[model samples]
Target: MYSVARPCEVRWVNLSQVVGLSTLRSFLRMESHMSRCFAAILLVTTLVAVEVPAVPALPDAQVYAVGVIPDLRGMLQHTSQALGAAGKTLPPGMLEMGLGGMLGDPGLTKLGNGPILVAAGPGLLVPSWGAILPYADAEAVIAAVSGAGLLAEAAPGGVAIGSAPDGPGLAKRMLPALDAVRAGMPADSDLRVVVGLDRLSQAYLPMAIAAMQGAASAPGLPAEAAGQRKLMLGMVAMLRTFAAQAGALRCDLTVSASGWKIDAVQALRPGVLADAIRPQAPSTDRPAERLGAGDGPAVVQMHGCMPPRIYEAMATLLQETRRDPAAAALIDESMVAMVRDCAGALTGSFAMRQGFAGSPMRQLGVAMVRDQAKAKALLDGARNLFSMGVLADLMRGMGVEMVFEPAVRHAAGLPVDRISYRIDPAKLPPGQDAAMQAAMMPTQEMALAPTMWVWGSPSAEIDAALAGPRGAPRLAAEALGAGWDLYADLDMALQMKMQFALMAKQIPMFAGAFAEVPCGHPMRMAAALGEGRYRLVIEVPVEQVADFRNGFAGMQRGRHQPAEEPETPAAPVF
Candidate 1:
């Protein structure tokens, strides 16, 4: 009778005990599931706020910064542990990836139930996000992630924001992978990660490495022992001679107010050009068959990289050397020795292409790039920017290859047929869109700019857009013409490649064919030659777009440096 009289007190004691045990369980469960932030707050809260119930976060638009997501299990594990420790409730359908069938070691069970918005790990800065980049660090990154999560809490009003960070160049590839995550996740998701200022060095070391691989080349060995020995000895000698040039160097990564950025998460396929370019004519080292345009346009962070003209010159040199025996002879033993030395330099150094020769098959790849002109131009230009040794250093700061060709090919398609591309090497970067009223010339009508090419976009939509009031022709009036350089929507280079390869079947022509290169389509050709030639610079398919605008603020400010801006949003609809 005494115990029954104290029913309310007994109930309170049981509830408190249950709450304590549950928290303990949550802590224990999520302990090893992450890089593990210190749960100091949770501990303090648990100790001091015993009677206070946890309040759910308000529903609001959210952005997510997804990172290093491997398996669904890991995802669940992270979510479970975080929520459990926080003692917060999870939104509905949060655990559906199926833990039973998922790999071993489930993460944490939900601490409670509540609504949440999801974002992925990787992300790119928006138009002006780069301004605050330097301020971001681990704590800042965590806040961005949390702030993004807040944005994701709202329903039916979300979209992912990112470009591929995981394409091509492996070591630093972030964009292609970011693109993949951006694509792979639900359309409503926004995956992002902006680490702290403290982490800037660690984050960008990989950035440099990814960029270097595409700009440099390695030596070729003649497969025979004699050939290998020749390359090795010459390489050793070269290293001894140039040893004085080797020293510690550091690069200051300036946070450009000019919006200087690169999504290096993907760089050029490392040494793919060195080992696979010209595989057909073993001795001539020219193409026997057109290597199927090896892959699609690899998303790369082209930081401090050369304009397309440099590559064009190198390609020409390589092609000339391949077809002409005299030119081949011109590449004397010394040059050959130099090539071997460059190849050798890869060893004990950061040149990613060095060890590739060790493979039996790779050794046979004496000439990865068949066009001697191209090779020479690239090598020559590379020589001036810095010696081979200095180049090795420069290469280190380049970028990473995120997603390889297969990954890019499998990712998605975007419709871009109706675009009027303006390849202005000297064009300026556009002024801030936000300040349009103030920035615009009072009399001139501002134009609509081009949108980014994403997975699932097609050119037909642009073509269809032309039939409307703001058609291609009207748009072209602004995006095209004399002063402006453009690749008139036709894929001429691709056609020429197809035409020559089918009719002549000549290896030289096949190798020279434009379609054989990555991003070979005329529509997306790299920077154009100053003037003239058959490069993909054309007027638009659209005839009239009063709203067409230029996106070149670089040109506006008279900044001569070429800038490649990715993930730009669609301009105002014409």
Candidate 2:
């Protein structure tokens, strides 16, 4: 539905090849009589000559995206050259021969861009010119489709029908609406399409919202749950606004073997988006401050944020919930107490920086200011909660130990304003020794090795208690197990090479294409909101346009393949 830039060329090429191969195989399987063979060959040739035409041109408003793909043959040539410059040879495969034959031999290249027009209607109408179906017989194909109930009438140019009419047909309806919308723009567009959100909203949004409202009013629902209905209504309102704005939306895509990019813009009208979302002046109540000193791979800092109105809204919700007797009864007392005790931890602004320098260290610094006295009290409460029988058992099983590293006093330092929690799996309780040892034992799928070991109490009292002549072993089994287990046996370099090999094997075009794309390929997205307009754009770099044919082959094969099960992530220790 959304007209974003995508890889389509290689797919179509591969599809045509698959169709050709299957037809050839069928011909070979028939009775080897000369008469039958001749007749079948003629039939197949006739069908091949009547290649499907490109999509028909529609009115400008009906089209969502217009793009041109650089000739794949040319792009592949460029890729081969680039790879040569990088001193890398492309993998040998059948895809290379397919690309060289279809696009042109990289050795004997031709240069030209192929245009693809996408119009919105009963289905996507793709008007391609001098692209895939270069030898198509337009008139005969159109006549065939009209006779086969695939089309009512053929539009101008080498266009094909996507499907039979489901209703009065999008073309018929869009033509009538053209005059009405013409006042705002031109009489016609270079490309015709009509599936814009504005058109859809005008045709169905009101009815959809009404139906949702009806569903929400089902019997036996409690009156106090009106919040749910209110939330749905709010979402509907936003959707309506977005649909209205989309009337003036326009998108354009430019695809190349080296890179692909798209630009889209939507006109905004006043009083459309909610007032709460309107840009507000910087909050003066919160003073500006840096999040932290940076030594980590990622850094995020937000300051002079959180407008007053947002807090007012939260307060209003809290008051309403407290007033509702049923809602108040469901609120947990411990949770409420926790919130009250920890509220001082959020002193307008806070900074948290986490990194691994030999070992992972997480530092959280809060601006408690006048509420500094409450930091210790909040931390002590947290320690008590985490140290409980139920919580300690769970934490120990997961090989995690939480310690409240009490705030250290310095010469004229604001230590009270900040509190820190240190996680040291090595300091787990003695009772968990056997469990830790068992967890570290190698499994069938993976192996673990200990790298660092620690023994003796981290605190003086415990160390003194075991200060006899012999004492315990220098490295405690539990700490050694936890530390050693952290050193996982993974060959990242070998894994990456294996993954590249697999992708290339599955998709032939990948050999030439993968050479041009840097690992993780660059992707960029941007958006902007203004007084009366909003716009968003996304860009992706594509390499070796000819390689897309493999994608098409995959799709054709997918039709007969069993659906694969979706992969799920491992369960969290918690």
Candidate 3:
């Protein structure tokens, strides 16, 4: 018999001394069974004790996005209800299958309602990305997705999946960053995306600069090519400087049954670019409010200040172009000076409006002036250059000649110059002269005052602009009241109808799809810019949402229709 060892004692025995051959075989089988049972128990206990691991930090990563779903089941139910309300529904059993089933893992339906992390890194070219997904049972998930050809590994409370060779490793490395992002996520945010702008600039700016420099300095290039290369190099250099002072850009999105909203901010380091973008005190007199409330099919209005850095960059680029003899011959020093002076005289704050009135489109542009005398001088210089036939000479090779006629008119007690242009029919293609003239703008008018400069197409539109705001304002006024820097509203249905009518012959599908679109509400957009951040909100009303769904369904059905050829192409009425 073999002696068993006590806690503090040791003992050894030969196999023959321990047991007989037949008895030993029976004992070996029993021992093997017991070992397997112990391993099974250990695995169960370990899995029970496993807690979700902290997301790994990826400091070198360039982009990171996380989508937090507090209750995936509830979100899915809400989405289904919303679709039903809009007269749409998903295929039967789609929700039960879950996203995993769509991805070739039907058994991976039991996912944890936690934040999903996706990240891409340091390398710009051939950048690698990884995703981490929380799971109710990591082992079960791994087994379910085993045949999906995805690189997946079990984490503490989730599964890490990656793009190519060793994707799981990348996913593991990204967990810490995900944890950090979660800590800072907004309470109501369903999604957050972070872009490491500075890191990107640091990694790729030098390479871009070097490449542009080489191109600019290359020998035997044409004069125009050399000038263009130099201009591009200058612009890239400016962008590098601007990016160096730029930090990460973060955007958070909040979704609800009503609509979705996104807030984005970019951190700006202390630099000239930051100063240029710094928001100024609110202005009492917004030019956009002066835009006429036209009874047109569509209208667009925008008001914003041009950054000083943009003007400086433009001047620098123009100077760079002048260094090349061929480019200088085309854009003389006087022309450059005139452009620079005109740009400098403007106070940066400007407003623009465009209205689509049935056939012809009308637009008005207004710019606040710092010095009216300087602006007038610049305008006079431009007219002199035009009279010298500089523009005509430039367009001569293109089978076109510009004929300019200037007439002075009065609007709101200011002198408005009514200018019209007629093409020289002799220079036009033989049979296309009348069609070309029909497409040209009939007239353009401009008015310069002490405080502002206004210009637009057609005399009537100009008069409306001169006559300040009418009775009540539309959605754009509400945006202004909320302190949005810029606002735009467009009648999507009207635009779609116009586009379809214009292209019905070439694209027969559009005509059929247009019939399905109900008269929908306008789409509205509002944007605000501050010292270092920008926020934009685009909203389509619930009514318009339904319209879009029906329109999309119609388009799908019309996609298989054959095209019809027309003898005469539809001409645009202006």
Best by lDDT: 3
TM-score of 2: 0.34
TM-score of 3: 0.67
lDDT of 3 by residue, 1-574 (tens): 4432222233554432122222222322332222111111100000111111222133745344333444455555555555655566676446646765844445335667676776655444544566677785666656655666666777755887766655566666666656666665567666666666676677777887787667556665533233234334444554554566766666666555654455556666655445544444455445655565555645455555554344544455556666655355445566556656745666656666655665566767666677899878866766555445333344332233334444477888888886544444444333333334333444567887787777777777677767765422355324424545555665566555555544444445555655656543665665554555445556544445666666666656666666555324243222
Which pairs, if any, clash in model 3? 55-175, 55-176, 56-175, 56-176, 56-177, 57-176, 57-177
Alpha-carbon lDDT, every model? 0.22, 0.31, 0.53
**Which candidate's TM-score is highest?**
3
Question: Compared with the true structure, what per-residue lDDT tens digits does model 2 show for residues 1-574?
Answer: 1111122322222222222223222322221111010111100000111111122223554433222222344435445544433344465433346543432233222222332222243232332111121113445544544565555333322232434343223333333334333222212122222234555566567788677666445555443224333333433443444455444454444433334444444543333232222333322222112222333321112121222233333333333444434334322233234335433433322122222122122222112122434544444444444444223333333343333333332112222111122223333322223222222211101000121000111122112222222221111111212211101111222223223333333333333332332232223333333333333444443422222333334444433443333222132121
The residue ranges of model 2 lying beyond 4 angstroms of the native Cα positions read 1-117, 121-137, 143-152, 166-195, 198-248, 268-296, 299-522, 541-574
Look at candidate 1 and tell me the lDDT of residue 83: 46
Assess every candidate by TM-score: 0.18, 0.34, 0.67
Better of 2 and 3 by lDDT: 3
Better of 1 and 3 by lDDT: 3
Residue 549 local lDDT, model 2 = 31
Query: Which ten residues in a row are the worst by lDDT in model 3?
Result: 38-47
- Model 2 alpha-carbon miss at residue 278, Å: 7.2
Tens digits of per-residue lDDT for model 1, 1-574: 1111111222222322222223222322232110011101000000111111111111111211223222333445444444443333455335642432121112223211211222222234321111011111224232343343321111121112222322111212232333433332322211222222112223343454344322222233122222222222333333222232212111111111111111111111123221222111112111101111112221110001112232333333334343434233222333333333332221100000000111110100011233334334433432332222322222122210011111222212221211111111111113212111111111101011121111111222222222222211212112222222111223333333333333222122122333322222222211111111111222211111100111122122323222223223243211
Find the number of clashing residue pairs for candidate 2: 11
Candidate 1: regions farther than 4 A off: 1-74, 77-107, 112-199, 202-288, 291-359, 362-574
